[model samples]
Target: MRRLSTLFAFTLIVLGSCSPSVKILGSWTSPSMSTTGYEDIFVTALTENILARQTVEQDLDNLLNEKGVNAQSSFNILPPGFKTSGVDKNEVLQKIKALGSDAILTVAVLDQTNETRYVPGTTMYSPMGYGYYGRFWGYYSYYNPVMYDPGYYTTDKNYYLEANLYDAETEELVWSSQSETTNPASIETFSKTFSETIVSQLIKDGLIIKE
Candidate 1:
């Protein structure tokens, strides 16, 4: 009886972990979009496109990994122009069908911009107490310790991504999501972090995993 109980508990834990946050059961693919005007303030146009594509691909792969789905075996990344025609649902469906995909995930770069600021500060003093001779005593303080200030630091640029999922067989809209944020001044420092955060959010939202 003891051994049976232990086995049952272990099985439950495995099952729980196997459960996915998203429901991307059928085969899936992403659409290709023009890379023009997608440049960031610091990253070159070519580099921005490459980073965006890699981020989106990584997000998709993370979704698959969470759901235990294999893209190479169960999914495929179709060639460009599959859904770039801006056609109606039926036409899009036809296009996806031609690519041998049961479902399609389209990601569009709606907007991409960036802003940068260099913050400068000095030590602040706060009157703490009075000395024996009635002189004031103060302590040194930092102007801003939290690292985020609205007035001193601001962002003028933002990045936006619009994602849409469609059913190829039925030509029906399945899922849609968007991600937008202030562009980091340094792409080298922020690209990977931003990508991982977006992917993690997608998974947490249960929008890109299989059950």
Candidate 2:
């Protein structure tokens, strides 16, 4: 069975709301490498949206730190004008080295899709009985009219993201995972779940030991 990438059952889920949460689509870990965790990991999220980049990286940093692992968000260390579309590999790596980060964690959006769904209206039974005859009339009078609640169409958005962990010293990918999040209500909520899920998966894959 494919494992669901979740360490904690986040309490923010709203019933029938399709609240934002991350679920792994697939993942792979390097086969040749033995299990040992990195001492310090530098976290980066690729996005043009500054808020999103900051939110996820900070959340990841907090979770990793709680596990006794050192984690730093690139937002705090990188230049303000850095763009995700293109980056200087050597300069970036040199910065990571300066931070004493032994591992590099990067997150990027893979895809986004929107779905529009129709919710059928609901009927309510109401009575406004009065007047008239015996059993037949009484039964007929028991209910007056059918009331309907108007239905609406709603659009749902799904986000696909991929996370990769690299051995900073070797610059070799140690693990990679792809995840899907549906109907994220807000960036805050998405970042909360996304960071939690990624941290949990790293521990599971033995990339970040929970010491």
Q: Whole-model Cα lDDT per candidate?
A: 0.39, 0.76
Clashes of 1: 2
Which parts of model 2 are misplaced by more than 4 Å?
1-18, 83-88, 124-140
Return the top candidate by lDDT: 2
For model 2, give the 10-residue run with minimal summed lDDT. 7-16
Clashes in each model (backbone N, CA, C under 3 Å)? Answer: 2, 0
TM per candidate comes to 0.43, 0.78
Q: Give the per-residue lDDT of model 2 (tens digit) for 1-211.
A: 2332221111112211555878988889997444677879999876656666777889999999999999998875675567547777787788888999998999877666668999999988875546535577576666545667899998876666789988888899888999988877666777888889888988888887898
